[model samples]
Target: MSSFDNTHITALTDLINKAVQDIIAEYASAGRAVPSLDTLESGLFQVPEETPARLTKAIQIVEAACAQLSCTVAPPGSVMINKSLEHEEPACLLVVTEARIADLLLDKPEGLPASELASRSGLDTRKLTRILRLLATKHCFKEVKPGVFANNRLSMKLLSSDTVSSIVCLLTDESLRASAYLNETLTDPSERDGGIPFIRATGYPFFDYHKTRQGLKKGERFPRAMVGWGDVTGKGLLAKVYPWTSQPANTTICDVGGGNGHVTMNLMKAHPHIKVVVQDQPQVIEMAQKFWAKEYPGAMEKERVQFIPFDFFKDAAVQGCDFYYIRSILRDWPDTESELILKNVRQAMKQGSRVIIHDTVLRDAVRTPESSSNASVHHDVAPEPLLPNYGVARVRTYELDMTMMNLLNSQMRTLPEFIELGKRCGLRFEKLYEVGETDLVEFSPI
Candidate 1:
């Protein structure tokens, strides 16, 4: 479609969304039951049992009214598609505001009214007012009055003061920036530079910049974020997938490239029988010790888990561990770098040991279109045809693949790609486990 057509479609979609929101609001105001999907699909505000002809005419009227709006009323699947594509302005706004609000909420846990927030953020009050209104509508914040805002459950979850939220802040911004340069980065050879990739348009590789940021210092927001994500994913993976409890009593689980020992700690907590060793860069290991040592107290004296300051890329120091668990680390590098890391990891593993690769994997699926019940129908026009299902996960994976291409020179590996890479390093690919649609592929020394 032409740029004008795209703009027109976006405008029309926005109008329909606004109309739908208004209809729902009206229903809320009236304390009446909201109309059902069947009612919407039939194009009649209310079903008429007795007057079939009038019902048909009303349906025509409703369809016509929607048609007059000059755009397709997106189907349920299309809503998800729109979200995945980040096509809607509101979606992007939501993401940006969520990040900013999370930072603000962490810095000022007491929270701020919209006026005060606008003042502190140096944002225009009028624009901030509009944005907050949108956020409040989506339950991101609670609106006490016309211009006042307060933290709601959703907003609180984004706070950097917490571990997961902090990591979310770091990753989400990097994701956005990478996405912004996706097209150019993919098409241009000059985009790739010393593992930095296309995001250099912003002037530095993400890791280099991330390392330099004051927020990333030991005991600062970034490590806490990493710890938070590690805690969440580690616990979830251990409970759902890994058989940590089934391992032998003498087993030593090495978390290679483990950050802040979050995963190691969680694994230790879950499988008390398993001794854990976490290895990473010297700086990260030092911070990891300080954070976990303080939190666990005498557990370090007891040696529940040992933090080893060694880079997995440099040498395989923590060898002969029963299981080598690497979570979400390999996906950050390209095939060549990943091969190098795997080779190093392989040198550390024993004959019977397993290497667990845990990260997000994509699947292919198609979208289907349907009409919106929330839209106001004009009496005279015909409704537009619904859009076709473009496979969603495929699109998302490609987009993310391009994003990683730009930001870290990494790519999301397909099942076959994983197998191929493993073969090159003399590691045989083993069974794959499903972790909420993401495949956790196992590798062993061939």
Candidate 2:
């Protein structure tokens, strides 16, 4: 097989392995004997005529065991039990909630008792414990014992006081507001006014709202979360994706809609020879200046970077920049809005200038089941397809896409969709650079 074919097979195989492992773990945790490999292989080949009665019995047994163990395994009444609601949890909620906890822990640094934590959060002790317990399962925190929770690496990243905490807050709030009206929004497809999207849900566009609410004060933790996320991930791009080493000295790089200039700051730090213009709204620019002054004082004065206030939807003010960098900005917009943003960037560029887009390009694939006796046994006794096309991978991507749709009415673009969007904006799409899991596409003026 060709390398591409081999790669696909390997990815598929790994996914299957992981799925199997998860199944085995679930069954074992429930105190059930695993099924034989022969039974599993036979089940894979011969589709079951009905939902396997044995599998149902096994789940019941497991659920009972879980109850006896007093474990918080999802109950039949839990939202996860309903196939439809399984993915409704907002991604931003996860980010923001974790960030809030992180912030609370960071303030104390030495860790607070459960009572103190509840008091500080303005949430009841019981409610806080339940939430923390759930988060602990995901490693966001560690339950020191029955009643207390401590911050972990993931939770630390989300702490509100951390520079990145703002991004989490921003995303979480935006997600929550949008999710509140998801059902209504979906029922009315023809509605031009996105009722609960970031722009409509908040009564104004995100940037405008941010203008009234200053950073760290406006409770706009989501934007800050996004900026922090970008900063952490942008470094990976610099080290592995962007061709920073090849770029000429005295190069002017424009960061379009670059909120708070965190990404630009990192880029300039990596490539000191390159000059940068951090562009955003007037209010955001003012905030960005404060951030730059505080975080990167002498570097800005040295002429390595300057903050410029310009709306990307308007005429481009980024003229003569060798690279127009937009990271994690376009994903929150629909095709029409994305086109406008790209058009502005195109107009600002010289012939050879590159438009570097750093965003997640989700793909359709299934997760593999792991190689374990429990997994093999569960597969043998389980019904065919388990959850139909509703495996872990599909559920994850679909849920995230749904959240984006509800909040911004935006859809995650496939590679081809991205190319088409670029074409619509009169930019020629070039090769894609893979940085970790993100796809960084380079474009030039057509």
TM-score of each candidate structure, all chains considered together: 0.64, 0.62
TM-score of 2: 0.62
Candidate 1 lDDT score relative to the true structure: 0.60
Clashes of each: 6, 34
The residue-by-residue lDDT of candidate 1 on 116-228, one tens digit each, is 77767777778787777776776666666677766665565555454656555545555565566666655666635543543455666666666555324522554566556
Off by over 4 Å in 2: 1-174, 189-218, 231-236, 286-302, 306-308, 366-400
lDDT of each: 0.60, 0.62
Q: Give the worst 10-residue stretch by lDDT in candidate 2.
A: 38-47
Look at candidate 1 and tell me the lDDT of residue 437: 25
Query: Number of clashing pairs, model 2?
Result: 34
List residue ranges in candidate 1 displaced over 4 A: 1-113, 137-139, 142-151, 159-168, 189-198, 211-220, 228-234, 297-299, 366-403, 436-439
